[model samples]
Target: MATEREIFSNSGPLDLTAVDWTNSQHRRTVAASLVQGTYSMEHDRQQKLQGHLALGPPWWEFFNFQPVQVLVDEHDLSIFGAIFKFKFPPSYGNYLPQNPPQYVVAFRGTITKTDTKKQDLKLDFQFIRNRLHQSTRVHLAMQAVQNMVSIAGAANIWLAGHSLGSAIALVAGKNMVKMGCFIETYLFNPPFTSVPIERVKNEKLKHGIRFTTSVIKAGVAIALNSQHQRSQKDHSFNILSGWIPYLFVNPSDPICSEYIGYFEHREKMMEVGIGNIARLATQNSLGNLILGATGKDSEPPHLIPSAYLTINVSPTQDLKQAHGIQQWWKQNINCQFKLHQYR
Candidate 1:
């Protein structure tokens, strides 16, 4: 964790003109287009874009990947380039029952590409820190929220994203709640490469905000350790747990059980519930055998029943084929053990 003073002193002024903004824009355009095209193909639909790039049909359709439409039309006031909103259907079963239709919005304008040439010249530290970029993303998200509220009416909102998007979502959600809006956020695999880990630690000390974030343990060890620093702080905005729930469904490796146990120890530090889906897999493979909790003190307090109405696919069965532990939980764990699979 770098101090604000250290970041400012060590990171010198940036020469924006020295870096080819035009080339950067071209690279960004290409990247964004590829993402848009890939998603459009998966959805089996085309969205009109103000840009000139035209994408082909879904390439991953054979993989059974569902296309989620995240509006990216810069020409429309209803949508914008910086903000992307995608609605996941109830059929997805990730949402809680009785909750309003949930939408996840990604604030995408915060990433700043460094001027490598200036670094070679020893003159790349005067302009702005990467956190400033995150701050800009926060501003853009606030504007988007104001616009969304006008058109969509009041609804439950969830924030999610990877990398820079994840960091922006965390900061934006915090600001949104300060404005009296109820927002819950989920961060997926954010890295601590650019921002100072200590700033994130300090921000989590604020009160009166409701934000829940999940990060892959391996993906954010440094950030996780920073969050752990303020574990005992009694603030509404602070992260209740040092580490979020650990998903343990990697059957290929023999030491996976040990890894799960390691994360479970950290989870216990925060007093958050530990979701054990491992036993459920065994029960599903063994012909409807009821697996009881290993002990009376188990967090969930019961074995995940085989008769649990899993949406369309067996949640436990899906875990067996999961490539990563995170995917297993996202696909198998419903709001409260109710598994729903997309068709």
Candidate 2:
């Protein structure tokens, strides 16, 4: 476990007096910090469950957020998420944006501690199996976000999570998008759950394999479409194409690095005069295609049509460091962001 200082040294205390809600950097740091606070909430719960005093102020204390609702897993009874209300001091007096979201629903990733490890690991497994949306945790998360959107309205609600929790956030946000409710979302180190071909040593071989795979997938989708009519979900995905969520990923994290390639490959396809093939390929995956053929409605959680993809280019020592949520708020990290809109 990292010390509090080690995790937050770069983030420091957020300056509420000067924070501009519209600024990208301010928004990313704040969202990442809130997710860290959700992580702290579970840690605080465990310490109290074992009858020990929790040390240090809440990680989100500097960000002026209060957890209004804590999401506990129904079956495992472990803390996994929270809904935080922003406290805008009156003294600040109209400095921030007039319509900034008042609440942020944030979720924390896998906690390996004895108390929460079982449930956290279970959710991680569900994520890898692409059954995370069917899990009780995701159901709870979706309901929580839905309730918040009802109360705060879509424009006044933000969603954020890390790792396994980010997958939860992604699915929930996708559901909301399907319902025509688009909430501002931030996902840090969200797992891609595909082959880690992004780590291949040969660039030419990597591009060759990906391009070939794209063409095959595209062909299969077209053949399947002719045999069976497209489902309503397939049509609804067009709406999803317009809702761009912010994705923060590290290039070295195998769990999320594929996203860097996912978007880049589409652009590469365009350059090679095969953009049409990638257009369909990028939308539907092999898993979803098989599911569709069998008449099961399956949407690939990681296959969003658009995103503000922020790639952390900083070198990391290992996958653990690269995948950790703390890296996002760290100072001096090199990050490059591009908007990938798949048409």
Q: List TM-score per model, in order.
A: 0.33, 0.91
Candidate 2 residue spans exceeding 4 A from truth: 5-17, 49-57, 94-99, 231-234, 293-297
Instruction: Please give the TM-score that candidate 2 achieves against the real structure.
Output: 0.91
lDDT of 2 by residue, 235-310 (tens): 6667898899999999889999899889999988888797778777787777778877887746788789889999
For all candidates, what are the clash counts? 8, 0
Clashing residue pairs in candidate 1 (N, C-alpha, C atoms within 3 angstroms):
12-125, 12-126, 13-125, 13-126, 14-126, 14-127, 41-58, 311-339
Q: What is the lDDT of residue 66 in candidate 1?
A: 32
* Candidate 1 global TM-score: 0.33
lDDT of 1 by residue, 160-201 (tens): 433334445545554555465645443333222211222222
Q: Which candidate number maximizes lDDT?
A: 2
**lDDT score of model 2?**
0.81
lDDT for model 1, please: 0.29
Q: lDDT for each of the candidates?
A: 0.29, 0.81
RMSD of 1: 19.9
Q: What are the runs in model 1 whose C-alpha is more than 4 Å off?
A: 1-53, 56-104, 107-134, 150-154, 192-233, 236-266, 270-343
